[model samples]
Target chain A: MPLPMTSNQVLDREFLEIRAKILDLAASFDRLDRADGSVVGDPRQSLVQEALSVLSSTQKDRAEQIQLLFSHHYEDDWQEKFNLPSAAKLRTRST
Target chain B: MYYFDPHIHMVSRTTDDYEMLAKMGCVGLSEPAFWAGFDRGSAESFRDYFRQLTEVEPKRAAQYGIQHYTWLCINAKEAENVSLSREVIAIIPDFLDCHNVLGIGEIGLNKNTKNEAIIFTEHLELAVRYNQQILIHTPHLEDKYQGTRMILDMLCDDSRIDRGRVLVDHVEEHTVRHVLDEGFWAGMTLYPTTKCTPQRACDIIEMYGSERLMANSAGDWGPSKPTAIPDLILEMRRRGHPESLIRKIVYENPLEFFRQSQGFTFKSPDADDASTINDRTASEPK
Candidate 1:
């Protein structure tokens, strides 16, 4: 039988995947930056802006996925066990 | 390495540009009617423009041993003036039979406005009625995504329109996949400022294998380069892409798409098998 993965292993894998995706996104941005620097105006600006918008949305979605994964893996008494602030407390503190 | 610039506005260009394009291996090009940097006053202005495209430009290109083809339509910017657009559309048939005239185009949304859509549909109707090919211009900058979506929706709704015969020009990275996925040809305009640069165009080619895709300079009166395709050639070479792949995108693809037009009887310089060369002068209209 296959051994069950520990929470750390699952989290590590997810982090690796997310990190790789971020690196890929950064590479795309770098390539766009390295493109012909002679072009200056709405056309070049719009192309870069649109690409960034797509990458930003993708990054946000990945972040949400990571948050969901963390929430799913958390113990029922995680807040108390970890001594983390409650949502209500965090909201108050943020305000 | 011969290349075909499937979409460019040569009316705004001087004869010197023609000589330069010929020197750079641009054997043929298509000039789609567009805004003359400003809205023309009347339909008569369009008539004169069409005459210049059909009569003057071809003769000038011929001097440099280049073939010239053209598309006719009141550009979307001027299509806002519906009454004038209709008048212009009415006179388009007079020039349809001209030897070098290809079809009706450079027609699509400008601002993604209602009037533009109305005029766009009318141009579609004319194209449908006459069985002409279409070349489209999606809007610029902030309006590009919405305008492209609107144009795609309009095109999709019309079942009579052959998606293959239509080419959506000025496509950027965001909009290009949607165009190609929907079974339509896409054109990447390589401009010095405002459209896809040579490197960016090469990147697009890498992302989307060039099937129905081609590139053009859109060499108009604005700040644009007429030799942009050659720059793309250089970029493709620098990236180590094979000559065949580059030729397919720059030369063969446009030829394949344009071959659908009855008026595009292009004879490549290499088709110089003796009998065919001799027959050319004999077939010239007396």
Candidate 2:
């Protein structure tokens, strides 16, 4: 899994791209803040805020942490929540 | 540059799509069984589908000088029917002897539903018993992260499963790292929408480096381009990546993973008789 480019080389190549993304994110947050209605009580918004915090953290596994933040927790009876049929009903007769 | 698309659904595509793929340097491709635009009624439907994958598609691909390999499974979206899923699983072994049959997959969770998990595990058991290589489809968009986690957990729980033989495909920036860290091959899918674009895929290649990583178009009956691997090659070249590195990701990596499957006997486009397709059966397709 050796990279073709050195760390400094990659950083030099992608620096602007990274900076632009951060700026874009900041602008998005600003836009959200400027909107009339608030999403303060929304779980998705909270997750987004938490993800931003994770990105700012000193930990090396920020991607993994953020992924888990948005993931569904394992549930044993998740099928009970959905009214999906246990057996498939024929949708179309193959021509 | 010659490349292999490790995952695509050619059953939903036309001969023109195959010609376009061959024209654009797709030397070979693998089509994992996928949802047929709708739920199929019986196990007989899957049997017919398997026949098409093993019999018809290869000849169709051969006409355009493209080698077609395939995986067999009842896709996750259809796996909600636990009874039908079991029926499909039972009949899968009947086609495993086919020359082009790669393994059991494109099988993974859709909504991370319990029924999907049950059927996913059942497919795993079938793969282990038969010693077939696996190709997985992690869920799309919003469900990807969670579904990928569940798929990984299921694979890890089975000690009989060989991590090296399994390919967890459709990985994005968020899930790619974990798939590679766990010693399984990762596939990034290129699409016009929903999955990674060529630019994003190239960025991933830079960040992750290419060991057990590869890319595919996943082009099916959707808003996708079958020529996407070439686009990835073009992107890599544009980013100043060496031809050798680009080839490793697009060509060598897929061959390496596929070599583990007993069914894969691919001849490179550079070979003397590369135009000649192997594994052609004298008996007509059933």
Candidate 3:
């Protein structure tokens, strides 16, 4: 059987993954901004928008996954103690 | 070369786009009510929007000799506001009898949230209650597969929905088979990006065959080409696909579907010509 990973190792891996995604998302935004400045109009803008949506969605999914992981591994009362609002509450407030 | 764009958003397009579409042999198009680039403040805003769709847009399209038909709904993005969506849904019936109105549509999941699902079903209920045809907007990207499955499942659960009269738009390769196999009409949106391009759409046609399938530009407020359907035509012709098959996807198929709507009274421009009578008789099987 494989050895269990230390929490720091897990955090490092996750942070690396998230950092890469953030860079990708930033690159996508940059491409969109460049496309906006160009004269190609519809096609370029659309291509960049599609790329941005995909990257942004990936970023959101990763963030959510990390949140779930953190919630599971941390103490049960950790959220209440930290005054961190529940996911449902956050969604309601935003909406 | 005459065609019909089964789905488009003329409300977001300028009059110049209408002229260009008409020039490119577009005889008619249907605009499904969707988000106006931002969340609307109230049901009254939707009321005015519907008025513009039913009243002003047709006149605009008429100037270019293009017939404009519309489908009404609170699009899934804004449907997250359940109380506002309910208010908007309540007002949809007011426009159903309008001459240019087609049915309740462009209604489906956005984020596939619980509230969105609730409003989707409520919209379905309204469509069923009124015997209206439906046009669905499946979510984009990663959400598309799951959202489409949920929409299809909900549709399957409701026997009242005639799968034939409903169209599930924005289908990609992964989801098209399911939509078609389930007996609902499918629409492939030809976009510059983010959706199927002309080449990909042609490939889909080759794989799926043309029965109960169509394509649209989905020209709206975003970065979209209103004339993307012509690009598909060119691509199909370049591939040596027969003109008849091309005509079926762009024209006859849309006619066949839109004919189900009581409000659709489209007459072909060639209806008065004697030479096309035989052509019409031959293609009527579609």
On TM-score, the leading prediction is 2
The TM-scores of chain A alone, one per candidate, are 0.30, 0.50, 0.29
TM-scores of chain B alone in all candidate structures, in the order given: 0.95, 0.96, 0.95
Clash pairs, model 2 backbone: none
Interface C-alpha root-mean-square deviation, candidates in order: 19.5, 8.7, 13.6
Q: Write the per-residue lDDT of candidate 1 for residues A31-89, one digit (tens) a residue.
A: 55555673447696567667767454324233223223322132334335435444335
State candidate 2's TM-score.
0.77
- Candidate 1 residue spans exceeding 4 A from truth: A1-95, B273-286
I-RMSD for candidate 3: 13.6
User: How do the candidates rank by lDDT, highest first?
Assistant: 2, 3, 1
Expressed as tens digits, the lDDT of each residue in B1-286 for candidate 2 is: 8899999888888889988998888988999999888899999999999999998999888877788899999999999999999999999999999998889888998987878988998898799889999999999755888788778877776677889999999997678988999999999998875567787677678778999999999988877788889999998898688999999999999999999989998888788764454335324464
Model 2 alpha-carbon miss at residue B206, Å: 0.7
Evaluate model 3: give its TM-score. Answer: 0.73
Going through the candidates in order, their DockQ values are 0.02, 0.10, 0.03
**Model 2: CA > 4 A from native:** A1-95, B277-286
